[model samples]
Target: MSGLLALLDDVAGIAKMAAASVDDVVGQAAKAGAKAAGAVIDDAAVTPKYVHGFEARRELPIVWRIARGSIFNKLVILLPVAMLLSVFAPWMIPPLLMLGGGYLCFEGAEKIWHKLSPGGQGHGGGDVIPEDAAHLEEEKVQGAIKTDFILSAEIMTIALAALPESGLWFKAAALGLVGLGITVLVYGSVALIVKADDVGLHMAAAGRLRATRALGRAIVRGMPGFMTGLTWVGTAAMLWVGGSIILHGLAELGWHAPEEMIHHAAEAVAHLAPADLRGAVGWAVKAVIDGALGLMLGFVLIPLATKVISPAIRAVTGRAAKGH
Candidate 1:
């Protein structure tokens, strides 16, 4: 019948639209995820350290716990908040992003400060946490989850900010895609990284070929240094990305001088390099400038945050007496 043909045609058209929307979501998610690569790298880099002190048997479990926590952060907390912001406080995205960037800068700088000033309050990252049968795994899990929440917040916010200006549903789909994609990328990589040593050990022990066994032994030996390198690289990334975000946001809000100056300075540095190295040189110079700014801002915040802010916060919360 003619009516049946029309209905079929209508259904086909709807299917085509759905397919197109899926493509759009995928496209936007990829772009947003790419924009968030620096944060993603830092996330992957930071998580491995949390499990370092654990027994080989416990390492994967801890990573799994953190991965679960990261998922909860994005789905339970950030996704909803992102939706609300898209609907209600769209105008506030830039400022909130800048605030997150400032926090990153502060954190990255504080690490440098603590390194330079031996008497500074040392965080657990510096401690030699030993693995004991009597250890409270639950507490460590909680600590790691809390840390993941902060990093996840940064990732989700960056992804949301990078998303294309689209309709609410489109934005939601893209963000969800981004969140799911990033969580898998980060935690999946963490899982592999944590288990790599075990795999390397097995290969080293059982490999029939000398070359294969040698490669495995090399991996086992190389992992510790690789992880250390990743940590330092992650710290640098946090400073570079965070400071760049703040500068870019300031420019968006009408202060362009810092950005312009940095650009010209980077260009000047680029000229000192051969053509092949020009782009790499420019990026290095810019990253150093951004990191320096991050360090300065972080230093300024720490004293004020600890001495003035902590006491005020304690007083407000009636915890001043407990400071003893």
Candidate 2:
């Protein structure tokens, strides 16, 4: 019948529309995820340390717990807050992003300073080891979650900023996809990094073939270097991304000189390269400039944060606690 044919065509059109929407959501999510790569990489690099002293069997469980907390932070807390900001306080996004960017710069710079300074403690130091194993584990998990909240906030804010204007539901779907994908990626990577040594050892001991055992030994040997490399890469990413964000934010706020100068400089560098390589060269130049700027800003902020801001915070919190 003609009526039946009309119904089938209508259903097919609806299906096509639905498929297009899904594709859009996925495309947006991928772009947003890329924008949050610095925070995501930092999250992955930092999480493995929380399980450093734990039993091998417990490492995966701890990672899982932290991953759950991270998801809750991103989806339950940050996602809604980001939505509200987009809906009501859209103007605040640039400043908030700059703040988060500054934080990344500060953190990256501080790590570099520690590496350079004499007797400087690196990551995973200064953790108060409780006598009770359970208590220590709980403390580490809580600490990691707390750290993750800040990073997750940065990630979600960056993603929200990257998204194009759309309906609330569309934004929510894209953001949810970004958050879930990032969480899986970060925690899954952490789980693998933390357990890699154990896995390598097992393979070395239990592998059926000489080649397998040799490969296992290589993995064990390579893990430490791999972690170190990952940390440095994460730090570099933080500096590059943070500096770029700050520059872009400043331009958005109408102080365009810094960005313009950087752009011009990048162009100059790009001109020396072959046409095909020019784009990549320009990007690299920009990244290097941004990272250098971030390092300088971070150094400036270090003393302010350590001597002034930290003390003030402790004083206020101390008084509040005493009052309580």
- TM-score for every candidate vs. truth? 0.85, 0.96
Estimate the lDDT of model 2.
0.93
> How many backbone clashes are present in model 2?
0
Winning candidate number (TM-score): 2
**How well is each residue in 219-284 modelled by candidate 1, as lDDT tens digits?**
999998998778667777888888888998899899999999999999999999999999999999
TM-score, candidate number 2: 0.96
Candidate 2 lDDT, tens digit per residue, 1-324? 999999999999999999999999999999999999889999999999899877677889899999999999999999999999999999999999999999999999999999989877555545344566688889889999999999999999999999999999999999999999999999999988998999899999999999999999999999989999999999999999999999999999999999999999999999999999999999999999999999898898899899999999999999999999
The C-alpha stretches of model 2 lying farther than 4 A from their native spots are 121-131
Q: Kindly give the number of clashing pairs for every candidate.
A: 0, 0
After the best TM-score superposition of candidate 2, give how far the Cα of residue 310 lies from its true spot, in angstroms: 1.6
**RMSD to native for every prediction?**
3.7, 1.8
